[model samples]
Target chain A: MSVTVIIAILVVAFLAGMDGILDEWEFQQPLVACTLIGWLLGDVTTGVLFGGSLQMITIGWMNIGAAVAPDTALAAVGAAIWVCGPAHLTVAEGLAIAIPLALIGQGLTVIVRRLVVKLVHYAERSVRQGNLNVITRVHLLSLTLQGLRVVIPTALILLVPTTLMQTFKAGLPHNVVMGLAVAGGLLAVVGYAIVVNMMATKWLWPFFILGVVLAAITALNMIALGLIGLALAIIYVQLQSQTRPPSGPDDEMDELDRELEDL
Target chain B: MTSANNQMPKTLTRPDLFRLFWRSSFEQGSWNYERMQNLGFVYVMMPAIKRLYDTPEDQRAAVLRHLGFFNTMPYMQSTITGVVANMEVQRANGSQLDDQAINNVKVGMMGPLAGVGDPIWWGTFRPVLAAFAAGLAQGKASLIGPLLFFFGWNIARLTFRWQSQKVGYSLGVTITTKTGNLLPKLTQGASILGMFVMGAVIPRWTSIEMPTVIARVHAHDQLEQLTLQNVCDRILPGLVPVLLTLICLWLIRKRVNPIWLMLGILVLSIFGYSIGLLGVK
Candidate 1:
């Protein structure tokens, strides 16, 4: 890769890292991160394709309550580099690499979050001393560390000789490649399962079954299926509201819903 | 509860509210396990605290109050920030709301909001939307897929943050009493949508196919062929995908690390493919 391209990839990695913790702009998600990296590498197709596949695999990886899911920033950016850069790996190989990276990234994230405790303490002390700028400075500095978490790994990965990656790819057995692809195909199941674990209730299983059966039997694209889902969700909510008696005046959830509706 | 400071601005100005909204987006910038967004909360509240509390002691107290443990879904923190901002304004205007009262509201709201927000945004909305966009990306090899997700998510998120903050501010102390069935109801609605989409994506997105010929039968003087994949499709088109999803769900419920599950899947796929029990067309 050219110097400019390498610099751009690092920049993308940095953004992905910052967004990993921030989780605000979603630059960490493979869909965006890979696409940007791929665009930087001059192969948008491979980048996007890898991103699309990786997105499904990581879709259900969520931070619910206090539990942190695996890290996507490093996984997405690192995988995209291999697939879209001089490594010339296939998307499936890229995915195979991404999974382990995600695990490692998850570990890194916990460590970083732990270390940031000291920074928070420092910020607290600064506040006690009445220096408000330390709050912003410490926060921004911590965010930069998050960006580096991915960038440093990515920089190291880029430092690996491109020919070595080619040699590694060439040495893989055909069955291994095929198996990796098969694994890739089946990997999205894990993400789906996580979502199911989170959202599934006895009452909700039927919608899932209905969705499966409909998609299996019909030629409906995802957009069409999604529209049907939206319609059904709205219908179900409406019927539910009509049948269920309002809880007494303390029903804050209903008020919150009404508040949401006004928005 | 009358105060001596009738001269102080009793409410945050529009500029102050905007500053709060803008800063709220970075609420997790300093996330740490020790306090879990305590500093982030302080960071977000700094602008409002500066605007409302003129005295050094009151400002110090306000900062100290928010520095306590505070964590929730990142997006949902906006509502808490709004409510807290309102309380700060009242306290500054001579209301009897103590630091404990402020902390009480923070603790009280974070749990419920996190419960609702995590599933709605992270669980339901994001997965559902990303599934669709990924499909588009893979099916068409188009830039629109990622673009759609990027814009779609941010638009909804930004709007939610803005509106929720406003509503929380306007509701103020009333929000404490306003809690009701909305939690289960919204959660149920999101679950319904989420489950349905998940089911749909299994068949549409997951690509497990058993292309290996499991058996061959010749009953009518002519050769007959049967593939395990064909049998599976005859039974149910997405049976393998569904079964795999269920197994993963079970294992996840059993507390197996997802990384291990993924590594297991890799091994299983290689083995299955090598043994001709699984194949890709």
Candidate 2:
């Protein structure tokens, strides 16, 4: 890639990473990131295809509080750039590459978080010393550092020779690759389960079972199941509200006021 | 109170603004003006600003006016408005809005914003675009697929950001009005369309093949026309992939670390590949 292309790729990566840090929706997703990378590499088709598959596999993935999900954006984008570039690798092959890349990206994120903590502490000290300029510098430094964490790895992957990648691919055993695929598929179910478990309500279990059955029958995808889930959630909330007995007049009025207040 | 007299009221530097933007942007999970003021850059700058120049009441008010609209995060317009209101009250009291106070507002806003934003953008908007992109990718017009994907996502992001800020500043009401409710319906429709495209892409994209197996329907009737698709579809239509996903789900429920799951997959894939059970081309 030319310097301009490289710069463009890094800029996209920065924006994508920033989106992730900000926890924006689809922009932080692997599907979007890979597609952007693919567009940059001049093979949006392969990129979108691979990205969509990865997105489905990781659809229910999330980062709750301190827990972090695998960095799918890095995996999808890295693999897309690798496969859809001059290498001309197939989508399946790109997917295989994405698995490990995602893992590595997660590790890199953990390290970045650890490093950022120190910077945050320094920023706190700057605040105490009444140095707003230094504090601002530190905050910018953290964002830049986070961006670099993604950009550096991506640059290295992009710069690597095709022959090396080919050799790595050649050395892998066939059954192991198959097993990994099987394993990858299985992990997706777990991802879905985690989401379901988080939103665990008795009535919602039907939707979960329905999701499993629909998925088994190949009659529905996550989106369909999610819609059904949403409907059931609304119904459940409505029923719960209606069935609850009202307390005495004053208490009931207070409860009613609180409910109205929340709205 | 004297500390309030120390700082300057200059417009923020570019880098400070960038940091402030990002800090506030990340807090999109909940928007409040108070939280925006205490964001990493803004929080740090307040005390320093007091030390550097004497910030008059109007200057403080002016600095706060724009800060109230600084919602870099999508779907957080309502909470940002609340924060802005809180900041206006606190600044008027002559109390320095510190980092902790800013973070407290952030912590308050994130949960509600996340509750609202996640479903709207992640569960709804994303799947809609993915459907179109997936359809395009599967067709011969693959190159256009990504372009379409970017166009849809950027359009949403830019439009949402602009609208959210405007709503926060002008309307000063929750942005999740009647319009927000329409997105899930749209998303559901798009998801159904995407699923159909995905069905076609499965066999086309993957190297799924099965060994020739013999089936005897009658005495002397041996059949050897079975392929992977036949086995996969016959078992449960999409059993192979679904079964694979279930196994992973089981492990995840068991609380096995994802790293271990990945490692296990890598090792198993190599073994399966070597044993000729799984084929890759």
Candidate 3:
């Protein structure tokens, strides 16, 4: 890789790392991260394809409450570098590398969050000294640490020679390559399951079943299916509101009860 | 400490609210296992605290008041910030609310908001949008998919954050009481769409091809070959994918770690391929 391209990749890695925790700009998402890395490497097509496939697998990997999901930032950057760079690995190999990297990234993220407690303590001391500026400084510093989390690993990955990576790819058995491709095709199921588990309830099964049945027909594309889903959701909610009387605080309790029952 | 009665009514101008909105984006910058977003929350509230308090003692107290544990869905915390900003304004202007009262409000609102916010924003809306974007990108090989998702999500997110902060500020405490039912309703609607789309996506996105030949049949004196996929299709199309998803969901419910699950899938797929039970599409 050229010096300028390497710098650009590091920058992308930093942003992805920071956004991993910020969850604000979503730069860490594979769709955006891989696409940027792809563009930087002069292979937009492979980058985007890799990104979209990775996005599907990582779609349900979300941080809900305090439970952080596996890291997509490292997965995307690392895998995109291997797949789109001089190594020229296939998407299947990229998938294999990305999954394990996600686990490593998740571990690093947890460690970083734990270490940030020290920084928070510094902010606390600063608060005691009545210097409010230190609080912002501490917070930004912690964010920088997050950005470095991805950048450090990416830098390490980039240090490996391209020929070594090609040799590594060449050494893989044929069955293993075929197996990884099969795994690649099957991996999205895990993501789908997580998403379905998050939203599934007794009342909503029909919609899911309908979606599955409708999706079997080739006529319905994603856009058409999305519109159908949206319409049904709106209509269902509307009918529900109209049928139910105006709810007071008592009804709020009943709503909670219903929500619990649904769960 | 009781010298605030001489001060006139303190209000947060648009610029102040704007600052809060901008700063709220970094709410999780200092997320820690202990006290979770405490420092970050303090950071976001600094602008409001600086603008509302005059006395150093009061500013210190205000800063200390928010130093306790605070965490929630990062985006939804904007509403809490707005409501707290309103309370701070009132307290600065000599409202009888104690420090404990403000912390109570923060604690009271975080859980419920996190509950609603996670399922809607994190679970439902984002995955749905990503599925469409990925489908566009993967199928058509278009650049618009990532750009569409990046811009689409942020636009909706920023608009929600800005508008909800303003509304929460304006509505203040009443929002908690009034929104008791509304949040669940919104979640319900979003989940409905989420479920439907996920169902459709499962059949389309997950590619489980069991092309291994399992049987031979004789019909009308002609030999016929039957693959596992053929039998599966005869029973139900997309059967393997649906079953695999259900098994994973069941395992997840049983508290199986997802990382293990992915690794297991990897091993199983490799084994299946070696045995000629699974094939690449």
Chain A only: give the TM-score of model 2.
0.81
Give per-residue CA lDDT, model 1, range A121-155, as digits (tens): 88888878987778879988988888899999999
- Runs of candidate 3 with Cα error greater than 4 angstroms are A242-263, B1-8, B214-226
**Candidate topping lDDT:** 3
- Judge candidate 3 at residue A62 and give its lDDT: 90
Model 1: reference contacts kept, as a fraction: 0.80
**Per-model TM-score on C-alpha atoms:** 0.94, 0.67, 0.94
Evaluate candidate 3 and give its CAPRI docking class based on DockQ: medium
Can you list the residue pairs that collide in candidate 3? none
**Model 2 misplacement above 4 A:** A25-28, A171-190, A200-202, A212-240, A247-263, B1-23, B26-81, B90-214, B218-236, B239-244, B269-281
Error of 2 at A65 (Å): 0.8
lDDT of 2 by residue, A129-154 (tens): 54545544655665666566678888
Report the candidate with higher DockQ, 1 versus 2.
Answer: 1
CAPRI rating of model 1: medium
Candidate 1 per-residue lDDT over residues B126-223, each given as its tens digit: 99889888888887779999999999999999999999889788889787566544666787778788888899989878998787777898969987
